[model samples]
Target: MTAPVAFPVVTISDDLALATACARWRTCPAIALDTEFERVRTFWPKLALIQLCDGEYVALIDPLTISNWTPFAELLRDPNVVKVMHAAGEDLEAFLGGCGEVPAPLFDTQTALALIGKGVSLGYGAAVQLYFGITLAKDMARTDWLMRPLSDDQLRYAVADVTYLLPIWQDCAQALQQRQLADWHREDSEFAARRLQQQEPAEFLYRKLKAAFVLRGQQLAVARELCAWRETEARNHNIPRGHLLKDESLLLVAQKMPRNWPALSVLETLHPRALRVHGQAILNAVERGLNCPQAQWPAPVRRLLDVPNGKAAQDAMVAAVAAFASTRGIPAELVFSRRVLENLLLAIVDGQPYPPPMWQGWRRAAVQSALASELTSFGIALPDWW
Candidate 1:
C-alpha cells in the first residue's frame, strides 16, 4: 500500500490572497471541500479552518486570519465546480450560515458510499481505509479549531481529509454507476440539498414532540408559542436552542398550564430568562389553552406505531429486513432497519406499502418481498386501507 499524500497547507492571511487562491482553485473542474468549526459552545459554528483540494493542490483557508469571504462565497456559488464532502451536513450548514450561500453541484462521498450498499453511512476514515488502504489518525477529531497557530499535526490531518476525498469519491461514484445505483445517490444528493435550503430556526420547534399526539389543538398553540420564544431567545443570545429551553421543558410547561410567575418558576427546567422575559406571555398562552373549547382543540395526531396490532407487524418487518440486509451484505439499517421499519409498518397500517418509496432502492427490493409477505400475514396487503 502506498503512503498517504501529505497536503500542502496554504494559510490565507489577506482578502487578496484568498481571492487569488480561490481563483486558482476554481480553475479545476472539481474541488474537494471540508470545514472545521467549533459548535460545542456556540449557536453558530466558529469556522476555524476551511480545506479545499483540486487533485493537484490542497489549501487550508484560516477563517481566523481571513475575515472577508467574498472569494470563498464565489467558489460556493459557482455551478461549474463540484464541491465534494463526506457526511457534510453540519459543514454545509456552517458554510451557508456564514456566507449566506451553499455550494452548488455538491457531491457527498458518504452518501455515494451508502448508495452502493457499502455498509450504511461509512465514516470518511473507514471508507478510506477500506477502499484506499490508508489509516487516518483521529487525534485531531476533537481538536479546538478555534485555536490559532494550529499545530502541524492538526494541519496535516485537515489537509489529509480533503486530499483523499476526491479519489475516494471517484472510486465510489464509479462503483455506484456500474451497479446502477447512481440515480439513488443523485436523488439523495438533491434531497440533501433541498433539506439544507429549507433549514429554518422556527421550523425546529415541531421536531420530535412526544406529546404532540395527546395535546389538544390549543395546547399545541401554546407549545408553538413557547417553542418560538425559545428559538428567538437562543438566536438573540447566540446559544444553543436547548440552552434556552429544552424540548422536554417546553412540553412540560405547555402541559402544566402554569398561570402565574410563581407557578412558572416552580417548573425546574424553565430557564430563568424564559420566566423573566416571557413569563407573562407564557401565562397568556396557558390561559388560552385552558379556555379553548373541546371542538377547538387540535385533533390527536395519529402515529403509525399507535395502530392496532402494529407492534407485531413492525417486529416481523424488522426481522425480514434484517435477514434481507444480511443476505445482501449491507447493514440492516441501510434497508428498513429499526426506525425505518417501524415507520414503514406504521405507514402500512395507515394504508400504504410496507416500505414507502422514500426507502426504495436496489437493496430495498431484497427485503420488499419478505416485508410484503409479513404484512400479508397481518391482514395488511400492499396499498390497502387499515
Candidate 2:
C-alpha cells in the first residue's frame, strides 16, 4: 500500500518574508494556492489571507500586513507555474483586486473532476472527500476571515486548503493525461481565467439584470444607462449596487421613465432612502439614455422559444446534436450546452457573431467541426469563435 502525501504549514505575516518565499518558489512547475476573503456588505472583496503550497511546503501569507507584493505579483503572472485551486472564481477576484495581478496557467481541480465524470459542482470539502477518501474538517463556512490575529483553528483551516490541492491535482491530471482528456481541463481553466480577468464595460452589465429582459427600445436603454451609473457609483463608494439602488426599483424607474423627482416619488416599491440618496443621479441617467441615439441601444434579445412552433425546431436540433455526440461516445452536454446552441441560433437570426465559450483548445478540435456541420442542417452556420 502507498503512503498518503502530507505537507508542513508555515505562516508569513511580514511582507519581506513573503516576497522572499514567492521568489524562492518561482522556479516550481506547479503550486497549489487558495485565498481567504470577506465580501459581506462590500463591492470589492476584502482579502485576508493567501495560502500557497508547492507539494512539500505550505505558507500562509497575511494579506493585511503585506503591502509590497511586486515579487508575489510576478510569481502569479509567470506562465511556467500552474496555480491549482478548487472553485477559484472568487480567489481569482481577490488576487485581481488585492494583488493587482491575475494568476494564470491554472489547474482548477473542480473543473478537472467534472470533466472526468466526478460531479458538476464540488465544494472544497466535497472534493477532498471524493479525491482522498478523507472527509475534511468541519465546514468553516462562516469564518470571519477579516478578523485580526486569526485563531489557531482558523489558521489550521486556511492551511488545510492548499495541503491537499497539489496531490489532488496530480492525481486528476494523471488520469486526464492517460485518458487524453487534458484538453477538456485546459479549455475549462482558460475559460474560467478569461472570465475572471476580463474587464468588460459597465454598460454591458445591464444584460445580467433579469428585469431588463422584459424591456425593449428606450426602456432597455434607460435600464442600461442606470446600470452603468449604479456600477460606477458603487465602485467609487466601495458599496454594493443594491445599496445604491435595488434592481427592482431600477427597472421600475426605467419603465416609468420618470421625468423628475416628482414623478420618481410615486414608485410604490422604491424605498424612500434610495429616492433621497440617488434620485438626481437616476434622473440624469434616464435623461442621457432617453437622448441616446438609436444606434447606441443594444440589440433586443431574440428568444428561440418565442418563434411560432419553435419548440419543435429546438427539440430537433437538440436531438440531432445529442445523437451526434452519442455516436462519438461523449456526453451531449459536454460537447455543447443548450444555452450555447440557442445563442448560436439567435446570432444567426440577427446576423451577429456568436461568442461560444467552449470554442477553443481541445473542445474546439474535438467538437467544433462536427458541431458546425450539424448546425448547418438548421440553416445556421457556426461563428469563428467556435
Candidate 3:
C-alpha cells in the first residue's frame, strides 16, 4: 500500500504474441482481466483491446488485429486459472460475442468487495484508492479504443486497470474467508457468469421496454410484435435499435395500431426518420398482432409489481425474509437483491408455478428453513416439482 506498483506493458498486436500470452496465462493461478470496446453506434460492441495481468506482468492484446481467438478462448475456459475482473457484465458480453467463451472460475473484484461488505457499488478507480490509496487517471473514459496505434497514454491507462486487480482480489478474498463468506462470493460469481453467458432471445427484449407490461392482451401483443420487428431490423442493419424506432414511439403505435402512414404519423412519439422509412412495416406488424388469437397473447408484463391488494402478501413475505436474514447476520442485499425479491413477488402474484432464486441455493442457505416456513404459514405452497 505504501508504493505505486509499476510493470512493463507488453503490446500484443499479432497472432503469435496473443498465442504466447494465452499459453502463459493458462499456467498462472489467476490473472487480472479488463477490456476496451466501442459501443456508441452499434447494437453489438466492437472489441478493441484486451488487457490482462498476473501480478508481475501485463499484456494488452490487440483484438482488432488478432484473427484466431481459439487460444484465448481456451485460456478463458480453463477452470484452474481464475479470471479476476471488476463489474464484468459488459466485458462478459463482449467475450461471449467475440471469443465464444466466458471466463470460468471468475472472481469479480466488484462483486467480491460488495459481498465482503467493503463497498456497496464501487468503480475500479475508487476501489483502488480505497484499498491501496492509489488514484487512477480518468482521462481515457471515452477514448476511441478502435483507433489503430493507440497512444502511449492510452496504453498506459489500459494496463493500469489490470495491474492492481490481482492484489485487490487477494485482499477481498481474504476478508471473505475471514468472515466465513468465501462460499458466498463463489456462488455469486458462478451464478452471474452463467446468466451473462446465455443469450436471451431478442423477441423477448420487449419485456424490458418501459411500461410495456401495463398494456392489456391485444395492446401487449402489438408491442411485442413491434419490439421483435425492431430487434431484427436493427441487427440486420447493424444500427442502434432506437435509431430505427424509439421505445416510446413503439408503445404509442402499439396502443393506437394505426393502419396507415397518416395514422401512424399522427402520434407525437413517432420520429420523422422512422415514419418515413419504416412506417409501413410497423403497420403490418401491428395488424398481425391485432388479429392474434386470445390464447396467443403474451403474459402480462411484470403485473405483480402493481398487484391490486396493496400487495400485503408480498410485503409481508419480503419483511419476513429480511428479519430472518438479520438473525443470521447475512447482508440483506446479498441474500436476495431488492429486484429479485420484487420479481419473486411478481411471479407469485401471476401464479407462476416455479420457485424463484430466493427460495433456492444461497438464499435458503442464508435463511435456513424460515423462508419456506414463513410461506407455509400463509398456506402458500411451492410446487414440489419446482
In order of listing, the candidates' clash counts read 2, 0, 0
Q: Which candidate model has the greater lDDT, 2 or 3?
A: 3
lDDT of 2 by residue, 159-216 (tens): 7888888778888898788867787678788788787666557766676676556778
lDDT of 3 by residue, 1-386 (tens): 54446987778889888888889889999999999998888876778889999877798888888999999999999999999999998888788767878888899998888777767678999998987888899999699999988898898899888988988888888888998878878888887778774545655666778788767888888888898888888766767888878888888888788887778888867668767788888998999889999998877776553665525655665776778667756566767665676666565555655555446667666554655565556565555523
lDDT digits (tens) for residues 122-229 of candidate 1 = 898998888778889999989888887888899888988898888877777788778776776676666666677753555335434765666655666667667666
Model 3 spans with C-alpha error above 4 angstroms: 1-4, 201-205, 232-238, 268-277, 299-305, 352-360, 364-386
- Taking all chains together, each candidate's TM-score versus the true structure is 0.81, 0.87, 0.87
Go through the candidates in order and give the C-alpha RMSD of each one to the true structure: 4.3, 2.9, 3.0
List candidate 2 segments past 4 Å from native.
1-6, 201-203, 235-237, 268-273, 294-299, 320-331, 350-366, 369-386
* Model 1 ranges off by over 4 Å: 1-4, 199-204, 210-218, 232-238, 278-281, 284-293, 301-305, 316-332, 344-386
Model 1 clash pairs are 217-297, 217-298
Q: lDDT of each prediction vs. the true structure? A: 0.73, 0.78, 0.79
Ranking by lDDT: 3, 2, 1
